[model samples]
Target: MKRVLVADDASFMRQMIRDIIEPEGYEVVGEASDGVEVVEKFQELNPDVVMMDIVMPKRSGIDAVKSIVEKFPGSKVVMCSALGQEALVMEAIQAGAKDFIVKPFKPDSVVSTLGKVLEKDD
Candidate 1:
């Protein structure tokens, strides 16, 4: 089972991601409500993949991704963004996020994106 760290400010979004991935055989090992917690939890957990929200408070997802990728080049991060945030999404990709999923998320898209990211050699 792949270990995933979910990061989003909304409680419902976190729960929804958990609900979507759990049944697909992914284990949600940790969750973060902001960019700071995202980095902290990432160091502590070192999960296989991180589902990060781009618009997080404090540090922002792009910054957090850069931090994680700078330290751990093998890190796999799939950004979560709202529709119309294409510029931020592009920035996140440039920052080393493996891929992205748009909200409101569809279960298949989430699962497929995770699968694709996990399939690649880090």
Candidate 2:
């Protein structure tokens, strides 16, 4: 099973993603409530995928993405974004995120996008 690290400042969002992603044959190895935690948890969990939020506290998701990508060149990060954040979304993609998902997430979109992104190198 694929292990994912879920990161979001919103507790509810984290739970929601966990509830959906875990039962769908993916293992949610760890969670992070902020960008700083993202770095810490990532070092500990070393998850296969990281669902990251852009506007996190302590560190923005963009910076986190850049940092993680620099440290772990093969890491896959999919930014979790809200509607109307086009610029940031593009920035994230440029920063080396494999892809992104809009907020008010749907299970199908999440699963499909992740599948495509994760399978790219395979």
Candidate 3:
């Protein structure tokens, strides 16, 4: 099973994502409530994919993406953004996030997007 690290400031958001992905055979190895935690956990867990929220305390998701990509060149990061955060999403892409999903996540889109991103590695 592919491991995943979920980063979102809201506990409910993390739980929601966990619920959506876990049943699809993805192992959620870590959950982070902030960018700082995301970076720390990413280093510790080395998960196959990171679902990172765009806005968080301490460090923004884009910054976290930069940090992770710098440290782990093969890291696959997918940014989670709310509607109207297009610029931030583009910045995240430039920062090396492999893909992105908007807020109010649809289960199918979330699963399919993650699957596509992970498949690109093969």
Local lDDT at 38 for model 2: 99
lDDT of 2: 0.92
Clashing pairs in 3: none
Model 1, position 122, has a per-residue lDDT of: 61
Model 3 lDDT tens row, 9-111: 9999999999999999999999999999999999999999999999999999999999999999989999999999999999999999999999999999999
lDDT of 2 by residue, 62-81 (tens): 99999998988989999999
Model 1 alpha-carbon drift over 4 Å, by segment: none
lDDT against the true structure, each candidate: 0.96, 0.92, 0.96
Q: Tell me the deviation in Å of residue 94 in model 2.
A: 0.7
At residue 76, give the lDDT of candidate 3.
98
**Root-mean-square deviation of candidate 3:** 0.8
* Model 2 Cα shift for residue 24 (angstroms): 1.0
Q: Per-residue lDDT of 4-36 in model 1, one digit per residue for the tens?
A: 999999999999999999999999999999999
lDDT of 2 at 58: 99
